[model samples]
Target: MTTKNLLVELFVEELPPKALKALGEAFSTTLADSLKASGLATAHSAVTAFASPRRLGAHISAVRSQADDKPVSQKLMPVGVALDAAGQPTPALLKKLGALGFDAGAVPQLKRQPDGKTEALFLDVVVKGATLADGLQKALDEALARLPIPKVMQYQLADGWTSVNFVRPAHGLVALHGADLVPVQALGLTSGRETRGHRFEAAIDPVMLLDADHYARQLLEQGAVIASFADRHAEISRQLRAAAAREGLTPIDDAALLDEVTALVERPNVLLCRFEEEFLAVPQECLILTMKANQKYFPLLDAAGKLTNRFLVVSNISPADPSRVIEGNERVVRPRLADAKFFFDQDRKKTLASRVEGLAKVVYHGKLGTQGERVERVRAIARAIGERLGGTALAADADTAARLAKADLLTDMVGEFPELQGIMGGYYARADGLGETVADAIEDHYKPRFAGDQLPRNDVGIAVALADKLETLVGLFGIGQLPTGDKDPFALRRHALGVVRMLVERQLALDIDALIDTAVKTFGPLVADPARTVGLVVDFMFDRLAVSLRDQGYGAQEIDAVLSRRSSRVHEVPRALAAVRAFAALPEAASLAAANKRVGNILNKSDAPPAAAADPARFVEPQERALFDALQAASAPSAAAFERGDYTASLQALAVLKAPVDAFFDGVMVNADDPALKANRLALLASLHAAMNRVADLSKLAA
Candidate 1:
């Protein structure tokens, strides 16, 4: 029953930075999980993961040396087949007992239990638990096998003839249970207490860990390395903030950049480096991106959030003077910044208008023609959308913006940094003497690109943005390239979600179906069935909208009720869902919803449509007459409120129908013997159904 903390580490060549965090977590969790599953670790054991550029490891607490032995009852075979008629052991029983390492004397101890129509013999035995060494070895093997390795490298081991595959060349493997080294082997290395520290700054060569819990402390003290990835990242972040604060500036906040830098260094020493102030003449985005993406540096920002010439570098070694490190980083970064400035300056020599002609040479997709053709389609769609939103002025600006948008793709700045496509376009548009509206639209057209991202700043931008997204969706869908599962090479799902977000969040009055139709028409003979394509695109958008609404904390029933109506104006969906939520809270909501479902089923089964109104003379039951009167009273106000956009009030108004509806169904037979009576009842039910579902399909809320 003795337990001890366990530690395991695998040291190798530098791992992929982006995959380090995931790899660390997966290795630790998988190792601990495998141990627990084998009963060598308790459920309450604590596990801590450590990862650096060169290693992945785990520290687990309260791991038992061996699991407890348990008595197990295993069914052998049917009693009839195991024993003779005289209750003596048959050859089958003797053979089964012999296979289980039991002798003939053990046959009398077998138990019988009825299993369906026959009795089965069962054997009870004690199962020995796995030893710590065996369990740890198994867990380590499984963990390595299950690692999320981005790529694998095959290399020969020291034996020269033997080879191994791993994320990198494995140098060492450490596995310790408390103070003792557990006998485990992995990646062509045996378990040991020795591991290398920082490549250049280790206090000692082949740092030796004294105990299972001393791995981290020894690494930091003697190895000159911060072994834990999270701790190292936090330390780097702290130093960066402190260094920037001393200069009265703030370091740019980028989690991805932080992680990549953390992975690149072991012991982080923050140093402030600078470039020529003249480089600031280029767009801050250009300089900032060059520093971060190419050099893995954090660009400092002034109080006004403007990029400063000074930047912070996280170095692996800490020198007493630190002057050489600072100067080396500055020298390395100058050319990158110069390249960015050069691209920007060279790009301005030729206007964006000149680059428009070059787009014809760039292929967008094999089936979608050239970028020039796509730009024309986008311009047409944008013009149509702009005219619908605001007359000729907006249309002209949108068309101009759309035409110039793709021109930046050929510019030096964008060619060097593809992420700056739309941004550089906006800059070049302004330099061309185009007005603010056109420039802003050019940049903002790619707005709301992802979830929670901002939408277009102006009506012109909105039109252009909508047009761009619609063109992408319709074009790809027409080519039978619809997104299947997770393989959306064209990002169709993102494009669809962008459209839905703009339509619903902006509360735009545009009709989704009509917009899709317009977009499809812009493709000319490329699309086969414009009408069917419209339906497919609309359905796809609605599906994305439903998922989005659910993520926003709306219930499935509420979303279903509103979307089930197939409301073409997505802007009204939120209001409809709100109304549904309010109506569902009413005491009579359940009955009314159920009654609405009943009415729909009856109408669907009918061969003819219900009459427009119920005849008073044909009403035979008092309940039927009462329901008709209630319907007349509720329908008028509900319809008026719905027209005025008071969806909540519209739905609430139908609550009055619950009693009458329930009573009519309970007391009156809707399919009466008389033809006129049955027809009249159906008509009354139809009117009631129409009144209740003005905002959403109430039947969806029944459950």
Candidate 2:
């Protein structure tokens, strides 16, 4: 029943910077979970993960040295099959007992239990608990096996003949229960108290850990390393902000860059460094990206949020006079900035218009032709959409923008950093003497590249953006390269969601169906059945829309109701949803929804279609007459409000029909004995159904 704190560590060469945090968290969580599963730790046990450039480890508190013995009962076999008719042990029974490390004398100890139609013999045994050493070894193995390693390295062990595969070359392993070494081995190394730290600046060569709880402190004081990834990240952030604050500047905020830097250094020392001011002539995006992506430095920004000539470097070592470190970082970063500047200067020398022809040589997809052909299709779609949105000026700008959007792909700067594709295009378009509208559209066409990202800025941008996304969706779906399961190699889902976001968020007047048809026609014979392709792509976009709406906090029923109308104008979805929510809150909402569902069912089962307008003269029953009058009163105002885009008002106006609709269903039979009466009732119900559903299908709200 003794409990103790535990520590485990795996020392190795520097780990992958980007994957280190995940690896550390996974190792600790999986190891602790395994221990708890095996009853070696209780639910209240606490675990702390530690990760650095050279090590991954965990410290767990309140872990039991050994699990308690447990009583177990296992079914052996049916009673008939285990023993003979004489109540003696048969050969089968003897064999089963022997397999379980039992002898013939143990036969009488077996218990008989009912198992459905037959009674089965059960064996009862007390299982011995696992010692800390044994349990820790199994947990260690499991944790190592489950690590999310980006890649594995194969290296020879100390024995030279033996080799192992791991994220890095494992040089040491440490396992301790309290102050006692648990003596577990992994990666060809045995557990020990000694672990190396800070390859160059450790106060001691092999910093010996005193106890399980002292791991982090010892590493920091004697080993000169910040062992916790989160702590190291926070420390580096603090230093960067403080250092930048002194100069009245701010470090660029990038979580990914911060994480990568944290993993690259064991001990962080933030120092300021500067580049030549002339290099700032190139876009700050170019300079910031080069420094952060290539050199892992944090770029400083001025008050206007413009990139400054200075940047911050997170050094792994600290010296007495840090000027050398600052100068060293500055010296190293100059060439990287120079390369970016060189690429920018070289790229601007040639106009984006000149690169259009080169796109034909670059393949977009094996089946979908080249980027050049894709551009033409996009231009066609963009022009069509723009013409519908605005007359001629907008179409011209959109066409120009769509044609040049991908031209930057061939440029030196973009070729070096593909992430700068659309951004560089905007810059180059302006240099080509294209106006701001065209340049902005060229840049913003790829807007909303990811979830929660911004959409296109202007009307022209919206047109080109829609065209680009539709081209990808239509082209890929046309070639039967549809995404299945989790494998969306072409990011078609993102494209679809992007389209949905633009239509709904921007409130574009363009019809989705018409847009799809325009895009399909642009592809020509490439699509075997343009109609079918259009249908598939539209459905896919709707599916993405449902998910997006759900993520935005709309209920499943609300979304289902709104989408059921298949309203061509996706931009009106939000308004429709708002109306549905407002309607749902009404006291009469549920009854009206239920009545709408019943009315639909009756109309669907009718022998013939209902009349376009109900004949009030044919209403034989008083209830039918009353409902028809109510429908007329509600329909007029509701139709007017709906046309005016006041969806909530339109739906609320229909609330007056709740009483008349309830009375019609209660006192009148829709399928009356007389054919004329039934037809008249069907027509009356049809009118009511249409009136209630102008905003959304109320039947979808029925329980």
Candidate 3:
């Protein structure tokens, strides 16, 4: 079987920058996968993806011209149905064989095999494989059908009456197998050896590709285009660093922005541009965001990490003069920076306190009332949390921060850039002379807006952050606005995960359930059912916590063993998980876990509660006496260590009961036919169960 490297390209209008990377990845992988599935490509086939603003392509190595033919034995039908009692083919069998391209003469090749309870007749035949043209066409069709297109546009083709739907207008399609042209058609375009290069800078109007192996080289050398997205990105990074290094400044690092810029240009040419120093009077965040978001430029930073007026521009064309390109970019960025500065200047004209009244007109949610109302609820929750975490001063600061947190929503700065909500508020807070604690808290309240994001830096911020997230969780849960699988329009799961991170990572001594209750009360009548919503929100948070821990590499049983207790001390959960993991590795762990499971089953089936302590005089069995003594000795050390918060040592202390527990269950009949003896034994077993499960439910680890 002869194999060749294949190259395929689809040229279209410029793609959506943010989606280009995903589109490119999906295109190459899906095409290669479809080829492999059809047996045209093997597991060793090497695939490289090419993506630019106007094209998506793939280069695959070791693709066979035609797949290998294979012999297949296919079942026809049951013997009784296919043949008569005369042991000859029936009319139905003849019809089936005719449809399968077989005939009466081929019936001699039929074999019998037992299928379930009946025997079936099978036919063995050699099947021809798909040729390169057919396989590549099928692969291309599938790849286009599933490109993760963000949006589709329907336009009429050149025929005027026929229409096609695609992410962008399709202009060209290229399909080459080594030096040979594979006949394939897509979007009304036939495969060709011609493809256009850069829109403006290509040396040739259309670069004539020679073979599959030279596609990338020809594009870069003669076409002024970097065909590989990864190569283009690395080239841009290298140029940006080199351009910024001349002035002893560093380019602001943003992966998303870099990827978007790479998608915008075919070949990158990094150039330095600058803005007026007066614009630097505004917050660096405002200037940086305006440049990056609006202009797609990288801001430069000094050695001290302070934003500088100079920025780097990734130009699509490298002009000999280059001064005009630099000037044009600088001119384009000036207005955007001016708008940011104007918004900042107009915002700080009034203190954050003045904006508090304006939030009443801003709706936080339809069911949750206005932002003003939400702010009041947050203030109450924050005050309560602060009072618990600290004494008096922390509570006062938390209340102030919570009240002013959403006030920035009404400011001109935040209205122009919503991502700067909390950040701008911090700037305004300081300008109003509200002190560093209040300013930092206002900024840090939204600290953990995403996964791996930091938590609040101060106690005041922790209180307000916790209160804000709790209010949202409880209020939305009460309204039945919960997140479903994949569709988290409200970001409830993220909010819940944020709360979990703060509680566990911050090690705050806060009960999530109690906080939910407090938050529910603050909602007044806004929450439909406060009591029920409390439990729902608590469960959702713990579920998120379990997922977070599992993602952090903790085992399912280890997490389940700790969380099954429904303990409110979330801060202690990590330590509990650590202790459970340690206990699981002990020599006596299996027997103890199994015994703990049996004890729980026995106690659950009994009608009466086990006594707090077993009556030793009624312990008629020596096995019961021995188990009771072992449990008594184990409980003391476990209790001492638990009081000191040494969960590992505490759980490890219960290992002494394994031998006596096994003996008791093996030699003594728990239901001794005497009600009092049974009750006492239940009491003894209950005590043992309690001692073993102080940190986590040991039964969850049982096999």
C-alpha lDDT of all candidate models, in order: 0.92, 0.92, 0.93
Clashes of each: 0, 0, 0
- Cα displacement (angstroms), candidate 1, residue 396, comes to 1.2
List model 2 lDDT by residue over 1-703, tens digit each: 7799999999999899999999999999999999998899989999999999899999998998889999999788898999899988889988998998999998889999999999999999989989888999999999999999999989999887998999999989999889999989999999999999898899987999999988899999999999999999999999999999999999999999999999999999998888899999998888988898989999999999998999999999889899999988899889988999899999989999999999999999888899999999999999999999997989998999999999999999998988898999999999999989999999999988999999999999999999999999999999999999999999999999999999888888779999999999998999999989989998998899999999999999999999988877999999999999999999999999998898888888888998788788887779888988888898999999999999999999999998888898889988889888788778888888888989999999888
Task: Candidate 3: list runs displaced more than 4 Å.
Answer: 116-118
Q: Taking the tens digit of each residue's C-alpha lDDT, what string does model 1 give over 1-703? A: 7899999999999999999999999999999999999899999999999999999999999998898887999889999899899989899988989999998999778899898999999989999999999999999999999999999999999999999999999999999999899999998899999999998999998999999899999999999999888999999999999999999999999999999898888999999998899999999999999898998999999999999899999999898999999999999999998899889889999988999999999999899899999999999999999998899998999999999999999998998899998999999999999989999899989888788899998999999999999999999899899988889988888999999988888899998888999999999889887888898999999999999999999999899999998988999998998899999999999999999999999999887888998899988889998998988898888999999999999999888988888899889998888888888889988888888888999999887
Per-model TM-score on C-alpha atoms? 0.97, 0.96, 0.98
The pairs that clash in candidate 3 are none
Choose the strongest candidate by TM-score.
3
- In model 3, which range of ten residues has the least summed lDDT? 523-532
Clashes of 3: 0
What does candidate 3's lDDT look like per residue over 115-178, in tens digits?
9999999999888998999999999999999999999999889999889999999999999999
RMSD of each: 1.6, 2.0, 1.2
